[model samples]
Target: MKNLKKYAKAIILLTVIILLVCFSFYKISKSRSSQFFGGLTSHVNTEEKIIALTFDDAPTEYTNEILEILDDKNVKATFFVVGKNFEKYPLEGEAIIENGHEIGNHSYSHQRCIFKSQTFIESEIEKTNTLIHDHGYKGEITFRPPNGKKLFGLPYYLNKNNIKTIMWDVEPDTYVSGDADAIVKYTVENTKPGSIILLHPLNGTAGEADREALPKIIDELKAGGYSFVTVSQLLKYEN
Candidate 1:
């Protein structure tokens, strides 16, 4: 009976250890500010009233609309596009490059990068990079993981390739998905100097709200004396 009790305790302890390790990995994978390997940048530290606006996923058929908006505002933003989408709509990708905006890799298949193989991670990034270059983007291409999820191989590969992992400090649309007014309010209230704002006016239901909020957010921020910059440009101002 004592032996059975001892075995039962051992099993419980093993289960607890497993749960702890799994929880740790989950937190690390979703962390926006830190990573186990390489450089992870969510926001810059500076006194300048400067911020970066980054849009993730797809340079879709609606690319021109966003480009036109940015053109009208004379604002330069960063685009983190998936490789497949860039190839699928090369002209839209070209349009982004032509506008002199920055391009970032948002992976090829948009898969979660945790517990993924090194070969798979390398292919995802390198292939997307090739597509970005193919689209005539001539600037340094940074990376933002799909859904901001990364843990091991992704960060290690990015480190090995000398690519910066870009995240965001301000995400208004994420909090109030499908509500343009709320997105605008949240962004205007939360944005700080040297903040990186993540938007998604490219795909999904949140795209509509984000697109509508983009101009309002820009106008409000401008009134607040905040100027917009590309992600790379914002990083330059980091101290």
Candidate 2:
């Protein structure tokens, strides 16, 4: 009976350890402010009123509309584009580059990138980087995982390739989907100095709220004495 009690205690301890490990990994995978690997930046460290506006999954039909808005506002932002979309709409991708906006890789197939094979992660990052290069974007290419889901393999590959993983400090449209006013309000309220804001202005109808909120967000931030910069430019302020 004593041996059986010892075995029970051992099993309980082992189960507790396994649960702790799994819970730790879960937190690390979804953490925006921390990662197990190198160089994951959600917001820069600065006292200046500078921010970066990052649009994810780019070069869709809404590309020109977004570009035109930014052009009218004379704001330079960053575009984290997928390889498939960039290839599908090379002209649109070039337009973003031509307009002097920074380009970052948003992976090839837009997969989760969690628990993926090393080869799959490599191909996703390398092929997207190559495509971004082919689009005449002569600048440092950062990366943002598809759904902000990355574990060991993705971070390992990004760190190995010397790419900084970009995340966001403010994401309004994600919470207030299809509500432009709410998005604007949320962004204006949440934005701080050196913040990185993520918006999905390139997806189809689902991005309408972001597209509509873009000008308002920009206007409010500009009114609040905030100037926009690309992710790379924002990183320069990091100390």
Candidate 3:
């Protein structure tokens, strides 16, 4: 009876340790700027006074409003549009291209790429790329995982195929209350040479606040003498 009790305690301790190790690996694997394999870049190191403005999600109902602002400022942004959104707003996506902006793949269903199989990762990416192509966008389509969480499968696929993972340095929505003035202020103040600014002004569900922020952010960046480029264009400064 004594030996059985000792063995049972040992088994429990070993199980607890295994669980802790798995949890730690889970967190690290899902990190935005860290991965067990492949290089993860959140910011590019460069001295050139150039920046990239990337918008994620749909070409929502506010697409025309944001487009007008970019047109007025003479700025071109990269839209990391989702496949489902593109299907819903085919016209909007096409207009984005016609206006000389860049497009990227944001996955089909905006699913998190953590602990997923290679087949699932491939489908999420490849299907989105196909949608991007259907929208008349003919440039390099980089990938930005939903919510910036990726793991072994995502990195392995992107690295093997030489696809760049685009992330951001300054996120105004994350700091401000998604107001136009606040968004613009955060962007103008935090921007540096070769910064990547992320904005989520695409989804109509976020209301007019985000839509209003689009032009203000653009005008502010322009006033600061920051030249806006697409994600691929920004990649030219990569070391």
Candidate 4:
């Protein structure tokens, strides 16, 4: 009986340790600034009233509308596009380039990057890079993980290839989804100098509020004396 009780306590302790490790990894995977390897930029450090507007999962049907709004505002934002989507919507991808915006790889399959094989991570990023090149995007290609998820393999590959993981400091769409007013308020309130603002305005009907909030966010920021630039341009201001 004594031996059985000891074994039961050992098992419980082991289970608790395992759970704690898993929870830690979960938090690290989604962290915008922390990673296992490579350089990650959530936001640049500068006092200039300049920010980068980044949109994830692009080349959707709503791309043109978002581009039109940016054009009207005369803003150059960054688009992190998926490989399959870019392949499917070549014209939309081209339109982004034609309008002179920066492109970043958001992976080919758009799968979570945590606990994935190195080969898988390599393929996802390289394939997307090829697609972006084929589409004639002639700027420095940064990368943003799908769902902002990353772990050992993804960061290692990025570090090996000398690519920076682009993340955002201001993500209003996450806190106030589908509420244009709330998104605008949240973004305008949270933005600071050198802030990297993230949005998902090209995600079909689900992103309508983000789309509506985009122009307003731009106007509000510009009114507050913030000039918009692409992610690469924003990196130049890193201090």
Cα lDDT of model 2 by residue, 1-239, tens digit: 99999999999999999999999999899899878788799999999999999999988879999999999999999999999998899999999999999999999999999989999999999998998887677899999999999989998888987999999999987688899999999999999998999999898888988888899999999999999999999999986
Report the C-alpha lDDT of model 1 over 1-239, residue by residue, as the tens digit: 99999999999999999999999999999998889899899999999999999999968877999999999999999999999898788999999999999999999989988889999999999999998887677899999999899988888889988999999999976688889999999988999999999988987565988889889999999999999999999999988
Best first by lDDT, ranked: 4, 2, 1, 3
Per-candidate TM-scores read 0.98, 0.95, 0.88, 0.97
Clashes of 2: 0
Cα RMSD to native, each candidate? 0.9, 1.3, 2.4, 0.9
Q: Clashes in each model (backbone N, CA, C under 3 Å)?
A: 0, 0, 0, 0
Candidate 3 colliding pairs: none
Candidate 4 clashing pairs?
Answer: none
Off by over 4 Å in 1: none
- Candidate 3 per-residue lDDT over residues 1-239, each given as its tens digit: 99999999999999999999989878876565777657766677888888998888867777887888788888888888888888888899889999999888788889898889999999999988988886677888788888887777888998887777877888877788547787778878998988888887776656456677777777766777778887778888976
User: Which 10 successive residues of model 1 have the least lDDT summed?
Assistant: 202-211
Give the clashing pairs for model 1. Answer: none
Over 4 Å off, model 2: none
Candidate 2 lDDT trough over 10 residues, lowest sum: 129-138
